[model samples]
Target: MPEKFDIHQPDDRFFKSAMSDPEVVKAYLQHFYPKIAAIAYLSSLKLENSVSLRPSLKRFEADVIYRCRFQGEADGRFYFCLLFEHKSKPDKYVAVQVGLYIMELLSSMVKKQGRELEPVLPLIFYNGKEKWMPQTLSELFQEHPHFIALEPYIPNFRFLFQDATRLSPAALLELVGVLLLERTQPNFVLIEAR
Candidate 1:
């Protein structure tokens, strides 16, 4: 028989522990994905009371599990599944990882809804050393010699908030704290690289 290696997944317990300190959570979320700060805040409202963390999956493990209503002031309901994966080190295979996450979320949704499959939009929060540069599959074909045309609608957004001089004492302290928190995990690595 083949051996099955032991695998671990972050649970609601981790989420609860991490979020026990509101300031820490707020700073982490704000620095990671500013656009989603409001949304994360809204979702965290019910986190302790209703949100289920690390919901069972068929295969891959999700880092953070959350459920929040995307309520429209007039429309009333827009339910979404916010799945988070915390990475301390860069994964060269991030695209594949994200793709898998989307697939899993869709499959779970299909079973939950008990209906035909529908396209789902997923938001991925990446917190790793290497900057996430998501490019279209077609972009891979750009060869050197000849000039490849540039599209007006290049869809790449880079988020860089890590400058030594710019970081306040408090921010630096918090950053170090997060690093220390994840030190026990194998994925932890020094992110002091330029």
Candidate 2:
């Protein structure tokens, strides 16, 4: 529970640290990512053990994971994995990195948890200075928009993207208690850990 608007290190690092709080994570998704919060059992949300997810290592940038179950499933045996990634910049190759990470996670899960494959939902949080338009995996591979024929051949999956740069102050008001989200300068956001 630090009490300072720290700006010494990178903002993305601070974001990752703030996300370590389950309350912050829940509030973030519940307010920012309602589509997922609607069907997900937020009460049962729990972070997975930390693991390296660097781009070179076939992982992602701050690949925070959470295990969740559907809200109202009769037999809550299956789990829906939420793969959270935060990017400090606009990365064109992010879809590729996320794809590889998903595959790696599923393979590891099958070995540990029987033959059932848990569904993974990739959620990317971009708090960069510039605006980033996130694209699907297939959209990145398709050089031209007319390449509809290749749609069936390549892997096409959509991800949940939250661009903090585009978020208004009102949208961020609820998260103030867990972590104070403030804009100290034109493009930089200062996060004060609670």
| Pairs in steric clash, model 1 | none
Can you write out model 1's per-residue Cα lDDT over 62-126, one digit (the tens) per residue? 54444444434222234444444454444554445555665665665667654444333333333
Off by over 4 Å in 2: 1-9, 52-62, 74-76, 113-115, 144-146, 175-194
Q: What's the distance in Å from true for residue 91, model 1?
A: 1.2
Please, what are the lDDT tens digits per residue for candidate 2 over residues 17-90? 77766767777887777888898888788888647554466533335888887888746566788888888789
How many Å off is the CA of 72 in candidate 1? 4.6
What TM-score does candidate 1 get on C-alpha atoms?
0.46
Steric clash count of candidate 2: 1
How high is the CA lDDT of each candidate model? 0.46, 0.74
Number of the top-ranking candidate, with TM-score as the measure: 2
Q: Report the poorest 10 consecutive residues by lDDT, candidate 2.
A: 177-186
**Per-prediction TM-score, please?**
0.46, 0.76
| Angstrom error at residue 91, model 2 | 0.2
Q: Model 1 RMSD to the real structure? A: 9.8
